[model samples]
Target chain A: MNKTIINRLLVNRNNNHLFKRTYSSVGNKIPRDPKYAVINSKDIDYFRSILKDPNQILTDKDDVDPFNCDWMKKFKGNSQLVVKPKTTEQVSKILSYCNEKKIAVVPQGGNTGLVGGSVPVHDEIILSLANMSKVESFDPITGVVTVQAGCILENIENYLVPLGYTVPIDLGAKGSCQIGGNASTNAGGIRLLRYGSLHGSILGVEAVLADGTVLDCLSTLRKDNTGYDLKQLFIGSEGTLGVITKLSFITPPKPTSVNVALFSCHSFDRVQQVLIRAKKQLGDILSAFEFMDRPCIDLVLKHQAGTREPFDDSTPFYVLMETSGFNEVHDGEKLSSFLESIMGDELIVDGSVATDSKNMTSFWKLRETITESLGKEGATYKYDLSLPIDQFYQLVAVMREKLDGKALVYGFGHVGDGNLHLNISTPNQSYSKDMLDMIEPFVYEYTSKHRGSISAEHGIGAMKSQHLHFSKSDPAIHLMKSIKHAMDPNNILNPYKVLPQ
Target chain B: MKIFVPVKRVIDYAAKIRVRPDKSGVDTNGVRMSTNPFDEIAIEEAVRLKEKGIAKEVVAITMGPKASEEVLRSSLAIGADQGVIVNTDKPLNPLSVAKLLQKLAETEKPNLIIMGKQAIDDDCNQTAQMLAGLLKWPQATFASKIEISESKDSVKVTREIDGGLETLSMKLPAIISCDLRLNEPRYAKLANIMKAKKVQLTTKTPEDLGVQLNENLKIVSVEEPAKRSGGSKVTTVDDIVASLKKHSLI
Candidate 1:
């Protein structure tokens, strides 16, 4: 038998046990797709020839383990080889060769994704984009930045902030998540209410298709009326259609003045009233409007260090309002007047304004760290949903009633965007299948009935691929499959993701 | 005991610099102005001394136009107890500044005075030395580390020299110029900035200090450094030698 066949046999023997374990979301054991080729010694030599650096080709079990698992630790793969390409040309050559050999490849950047989109499901080759981090160019006049796919989000922000500009997106994982991954997933963050979505801000993208054809759509112009916007397909394709190599996005000017105010609401209805009033009063200056329930705040105080309640008395809900503007005096006056109006109208029970940077950071932390604090409680069933603004907290209420004290159910997220992060966890900090079963189809059905998105910002990776039907129509999904087939006929790019099997 | 710290407002180090059209000096119009980074380190050290209970108060003083009061406010936000500004629109040299500071020192009578080794704009490392000379006090320059004695009458400073460190001990009422490794400055909190507006800031003129501006130096013109040209490729050692000979650099 050939050496490649022998290696494939060994890999199959090793993964035979994993095949018996079924995934909870898909409710089926995902067998290794037989069409994909396994990595052998010859394949490693080929990768080494293209990479030209021995350190870039990771074959040791210890070195490649981090790439094989995701940040959530929910999905693990058995990829035997990992390759880090330093240039777009190197990535092109590697992908072209892999396409010819019918080997599956997973393109990863930062590997901080909540979904298992960046990791391989089976013994596929891992294409890590860790070495291709560089800022190609930045137009100071136009405020457009062109950077490689592997640059960390926070690094780019720091680079632009001193120049009187900043990247429009801001996420909690900014210190680790890569800009390329952000564009690929169409990440919606706190600044979305002010700067809009990546679809509007990302001017151009350079990507390589499954056949190694370089699609150079990296245009820096704000307006391009040319035929089809081909780059939009790869924006949220989750690396299935192609690999995003570089991006050019417009950045917003850094705000000279920022003010934050935390408000305590008696009920969810009061929170909505406060939001309505804030939108009308703090018109062009409102940058963020986020909310968290009392339970969420309680968990943050219990788990997160150096966190305290913003008010003396506890309430049913809390709202964090942020404002950014150019004139400090004008913005400060506006924020104070808005606060006074809301308090006088009895829309809020209590409120506290952040008089300094320390208070501002602490107030934002109380809202931003809710997700991190929830992870400490137990195995959480996380859902990022987009629903009607009025019915935002109804699902959380329904789940809380359904679980009936068995699990802790709470809600928090960007209220300005109608996005809610509904989380459920047990008190014992263990993964329970019964709890997951009670949450899944019902959650999807409720979301579908409300005509809401089941997966709001987090893409439908291996976790929610089967549940995509709840949000997307049959015709829309059919067209998506056709597009995927037309772009990648061999299905060698990020298999078993985005599209349903 | 009280400590006096002198801060200077200069163009932000990160801002792009441009020369004036008349070649007189660098253009300052529309440029971001900030407290000299070294002076920020000096203010940080003084505030830390007060926090440690070694110094009872910190007084930040600056001499410039009215806009320079922003730097004094910043220092106040960073934990200075009081501020004093010598309001002067006319340009002042190192010697003129030293004379004004000497006049203030006679009345304030602070136990210690700390300042930056040099201003980034002029790079003139003379004000501290001149002040110490005029006051007849011991002086320590390029101080990377500082330690005050238990009795608080003397201090020890570790200076960063070319190849090694030098330690110097000075009596009370000494002058110390801070080096880059002294300490990292803290950002001014918003609450403190709001409160800094109410801090007592005394304003005085150069005439009020009984000092007349007398400058001994004059700058005829200012120009940017010459741009470097690209080098030619050489294939052999003889070619390199020929290139060097052509440029008269051999």
Candidate 2:
């Protein structure tokens, strides 16, 4: 439960290989494997020869810093070389050499993950997917797009706009996050409740294994229930097993008529009631049901530019409900009736509906840009958790109680999908060991007590791998470890990740 | 009032058009194409008029190759009562297009012809005026706002100009060209597109219409704009400030 015991236990972690690096942002040495070759100048020459572009090899201190850090700047890696491979064959060659030399590699996508998954934990060579972004194949009729792993999510969405299709996954990081990274992390955004998880939506994956072996399970058909769904294993693996090079998936047709309503609820219970009413009344039209506390709205309105309070008055909690239907007038009437009933039943206090396209976009900003606004305020100890609909607020309340007013605690997330992004705004603008010590294990333990997932949407990157046991059973994790070792026997794919040390 | 909207197919604004190696013109091969953005605004305005019950019917027309039907179909998808394509292989200048539109105007006899002030591909703001002249009808060009008179006899259009705003009242059968500020076009739904596909699109050859199109102006050659290289990024704000001070610009 404490640092000494935790560090001592981590010291005895039975990793196949172990090496300790000198520096880390978290003040803990990554249990890097010693069997993995320390990256040397010779490796850079070999990687440069295989990648073919000297510019693809980033070794400059400034150029390498961005790849070495996570999106939140919470974790930093000291890796000297970052190799970008444009083709799968290039990745094959690089990995083959790295496997032969026992050099560790961290496959990086957009590097926009909230967790520290994309960056190297130690002196591992970084294999970036930026150069591999291309639309390999597109079937406009079927709405299935086959894209190289590094295509930015926004680019894909824009590319499919003319075809009347849209990428199912939508997140705040869509502008920067790659489709491969989203698949790698199984990133759940606001649309997950509507389009379903990427596990079902993603059709196939083509990846390069640890030892230069190509795993091409890239199928584009909607229904291929042949044998074990091998692609599901790589969906949330966080790049520990292989480097995702290409993906072929079906994109859902873009919803024609989308309407958003921002409403203030009296409490979490009232929010749940409104959610139930929306699902029952709006039915198929209800796409997103997101809620945030009063503090979150206030912070967003204050810090985020051009964003105003959705309602005239404030309530304890707020919900942003979106509905999509073919007929605008019909869908508008349905949303209006739902809103009237929720307001009439006193489940919601104040509400505003987006009557026009302009208002709809403005209303979405109040909920979509919360993460950026949170960062502007102070240090954020962010946790993305999955709990039962009724039990979501309990963890937030517990965290607030434990912090005891030392931090500004708030929760907001896709409540329709039972995912809560619990955040703690540290009084200091930076994290302290004391604050984390109080927050961790306790949050994980509470989530475990409630049979909730410790890392929902975001995968078990380096940050939460130690506590993954809280969510997965021993046997299940044992199987996971076996799969990890089998796929990457030398532990060279992405060492010190996913599977616990 | 009956509205006739002439939309054109052009390379989508989002597309970065590349010039062919021969330098004859822009390489349209494998490039994304869409209805000219300004014409899209005109279509939106016409659709709004029909939705508001100010206009009885919305008819869309285009003249070009078979590929031009796509724009007409897009117009129908957004909200057009009927679509007509004047099939012709010859490159039509603004004058030739105006002459062809005049023939259509004489036959269809729409009360008002709503169109874009200028197609983005050419940026030639001539078709509306030429058509108005050819039909001997009043015209309101560069219209940012259009208000159909309840009497159904005329339209008061608010036009944007360098000096200020110009308000003009034009009689029925006038050509009203739209500007950018008319309205924002909505994303046509899948259902509407499917319905649009089912919507009747009439195709008539230029010979059948007895309308001849000829290119009066020739585009000599086209070249792509120079590619801009990335500027050096300052590592920090302090570095930016120091660099600016070093250059004596601070």
Candidate 3:
């Protein structure tokens, strides 16, 4: 039945001959990019007042430029209008009007996305969910929180923490990322090792379809077992499925005891050993398992002068681990005994554990500082890849050898989950292109060989679209395109993102 | 026709905000607060139409802390039919804010609702769009022109787009957000001050809305943008051209 629907759409495309044959030899064919004509000023005002009032729409280029791009600054596009609807009905009506006019609507959440998923890729109309950020319902007893998709992750976390509940997933971009975008991208944050994916915790999603129909699926049930699971289809569809307006999600209980520790390892082999021991000893209590290489530590020490590691001498690698349990001493004891057990193996050379909440935060600062430290480390090339925990460190070692001192390479992994951030830096602009071209394919090839993902967390925005095949299978790619075509058959929603052009 | 206008209180547009050294957030110290300028225009437009007798009533609502009443009072002072303030200290995003407003609108069922295009703070710009989605209402954004139908049940709107304009029409009970081009919002006067003080404001909390905050996304730090060093100013046309040529910006 779905294939028939796709065939019908394909036949329409074929009839018009709008599909371009030359697809740049990358991956997917470029269906003629959607054409967008500017909405007139008078029409802009008319649509503006159709909202609760005419005062909330942003149209001036200066006012909307920040909304047109994500934090990556890699994908930039122009949009003629930005619409903020205060209610779901308004969104439906707005979309219906846009559909009639053949005005492609790109839904945007928090523009902090690393992928260009949340921004316009053409002169399409930008339908912002900014005004839709309202808490509709919460059942503390059931541990479910329902909110509009545009709510800031940090804001939601702050609200839940004080109430003895917490947003299960946490990431560095939480403050800037919206819940809708988080759900849309199926964001795997630092806490994914503990909370799992949104596919489990996200109870339901209310989305606006292409024809302005509202898919009202905001149910707070843990197990629906419904036929087809329509909500799951939109979770990681990257807004190609529909514009997520609201979400019902399950929140985890706030941990009573939290301990963070940073350890220095002399070898990548030892680092993996320590991670295995920590996971085994800590069990479910282990919340985060982060790995950092020597170059990463060196960059931090150089850029952030006051910050220092516990080791007297520079080590080849460092590991930061956090464990949250019901009892502070029990968790501490487990962590200490694990360290002692590994001492004989010499998996860890030096380490420090946080005794208090303040100290725990202080310890985690080293891991969080990695993003900022990279800015100071020359012309840097960054790749966030997900591979087998065992092979992650080895890939970095191999890449370092391949660079042969032409560039410096650093590796870090969220060991609990298979995500690693590998950064390469060229000393000068003369070697930038070589470093990028050589490192990108080399890293992606290894990731593919190990059945790893090229984009672990930061999405396949314009930056990684060329290498999407490394992580995605041809069938997966075709299905993703079919989903995109099913909803935005006009090929309008964030064009040239996620899928190759 | 009765219109509902939503107002938001945010940091004053002109003020240069500084992030606290602790990396928590911007220091609100000496930071002036004001009605989000676009929302102020929304209130003004609604009140103007009411005064002209085109609108039978102008209701003003706000979603923020009690301090936001200052902005709400400005709306009431501008002659809104009444005021409702969802009193909560929680920092709401577009999704939650839209849900709360949708609930309020469901009860009141105003013929029209108006709000700023986007809040200055957070700047997610999701509220209006998501609200439209939730309420399933038609929306005209960045409106430069709005005309009520003779039947008073439909509206014709002009929206601002990049490089050009778009014209749209929809039945009443629609939503319209305002832009800078909408109108010059007027300041509240002393005469209306007494009237605004008496205006009732409704308050709601996160619990009231049945939603708790998602804490997974925490703020590690809020640092100020790195300051750029002062560049040589080219005031004269000759100097501007020379500087552009030197930088290859020409």
Best model number under TM-score: 1
Evaluated on CA atoms against the true complex, candidate 1 attains a DockQ of 0.04
lDDT-based ranking, best first?
Answer: 1, 2, 3
lDDT of 1 by residue, A1-501 (tens): 011101110001112222222233334436788888877899889988989989899999999988987765557888988998998888898889999999999989877776688888887788887788899999999999999999988888878877888889888777778998998888897889889999999999999888888899999999998999988988988999999999999999887667677888899899998888889989999999999999999998997676786666799999988888888669867876777677678888777665334446667778877767765665678899999988999999999999999888989988888999998866544545576788988998999999999988988877788889999999999999999999999999999888889
List each candidate's DockQ score. Answer: 0.04, 0.03, 0.01
- Scored against the true structure, residue A242 in model 2 reaches a CA lDDT of 89
Alpha-carbon lDDT, every model = 0.84, 0.81, 0.73
RMSD of 3: 26.6
Off by over 4 Å in 1: A1-29, B1-250
Q: Model 3 reaches what TM-score against the true structure?
A: 0.61
Which candidate do you rate higher for TM-score, 1 or 3?
Answer: 1
Worst 10 residues of 2 chain B by lDDT: B186-195
Q: What is candidate 2's CAPRI-style docking category based on DockQ? A: incorrect
Q: DockQ rank, highest first? A: 1, 2, 3
Instruction: Write the residue-wise lDDT of candidate 1 on B1-250 in tens digits.
Output: 8999999999766455678999989998755567887888899999999999999999999999998888898899889999999999999899989899999999999999999999988899999999999999999999999999989999999999999999999999999999999986664544455567678799999999999986778878989889899867898999999989998998
Report the CA-based lDDT of candidate 3 relative to the real structure: 0.73
On DockQ, the candidate that comes out on top is 1
